[model samples]
Target: MLTTRLPTKVEPYRLASSGKCLEGVIPLADMPRVVEAIGVQESDVRISLTFDIDSQRRSFIEGSISFEASLLCQRCLRPTEPEPLSSDFRLGLVTSDALAAQLPGEYEPVVVENEQLDLLSVIEDEVLLVLPQVVYHEEADCAVSRDQLASGVEPEASDAPAVNPFSVLRTLKDKH
Candidate 1:
């Protein structure tokens, strides 16, 4: 766990050239997009990033992000217990679309403008990607029970034989 706040922006090329590694924390409240998506956020996001020039001569950032979040439960429509979420990503830093396109499939291309990358934005993007599409508590913990979900009135059984509309069509065809 990192207690120091991370820099919001950095020069990826410079970091990569020096083989720098950054480990820090970003307050969850600072990321509005994440807050909006998760509904509730009360903790800091732990981030670790290593910047290096790979053997392929590609400058990239390998990052890991972890955080606890309280997401709205799809079943109960309420906030669930804080759940841990994390993501690991490798981003190839590029200054142009051509360079971005040349990056291999293993590396997701990140375009740097004016040689400066918004580190927070990248971290926030990873956090968003890691969020569960539909959050739900364990069956025992959920407020809405399976029985309630399956509780619709069952159709009453009748003694009469079922009538088929196709029977009339069959009768007409036989008469012809």
Candidate 2:
């Protein structure tokens, strides 16, 4: 989870080439927007992050994130477990003066202070970025109900039973 308390206090520096950090699974209950965004139930949430910091002028933070989640299919409204979600991106830590020069227009620059970085915020951003906009299940596994298909009646077919007018006339004469 990456965060910024004070933008100015963050000092810019190169990242360490290698490091290992792990955060326990965060409870997904309070984060309703995030859960809805990912289309996953709060119970199935899991996140694991691994990162490597580069030693360049502006060291690059490279990492892979994996998530185990379940989402509802859009068409059939069935629960689906997609292949484990994973994504990779770089974190560019820079100072106020060199912020624009170091970070390109496309890359998101995270401001750092006092040569310290918040690990949690970084992980959060990465997680959100990896989620797909729309969630859906495979067609073969979808669970649409069969009854819904049988209810639509064809316009040309009338529901009333056929009766002969001549038979009715003969029956009336016999009765008289």
Off by over 4 Å in 1: 1-3, 150-176
Off by over 4 Å in 2: 1-33, 39-56, 97-101, 104-108, 113-116, 145-176
| Superposition TM-score, candidate 1 onto the true structure | 0.82
Task: Return the clash pairs for model 1, or none.
Answer: none
Summing lDDT over every window of 10 consecutive residues in candidate 2, give the lowest-scoring window: 3-12
Candidate 2 residues 1-176, lDDT tens each? 34212121222243233444333454434345666665534443344333344443445455565666666677677667755677766666665657746676544677666677765556556667777667766555667645543668667977898777689889889998
**Collision count of model 2:** 12
* Cα RMSD (angstroms) for every candidate in the order listed: 4.5, 14.7
- Against the hidden true structure, what lDDT does model 2 obtain? 0.55
Root-mean-square deviation of candidate 1: 4.5
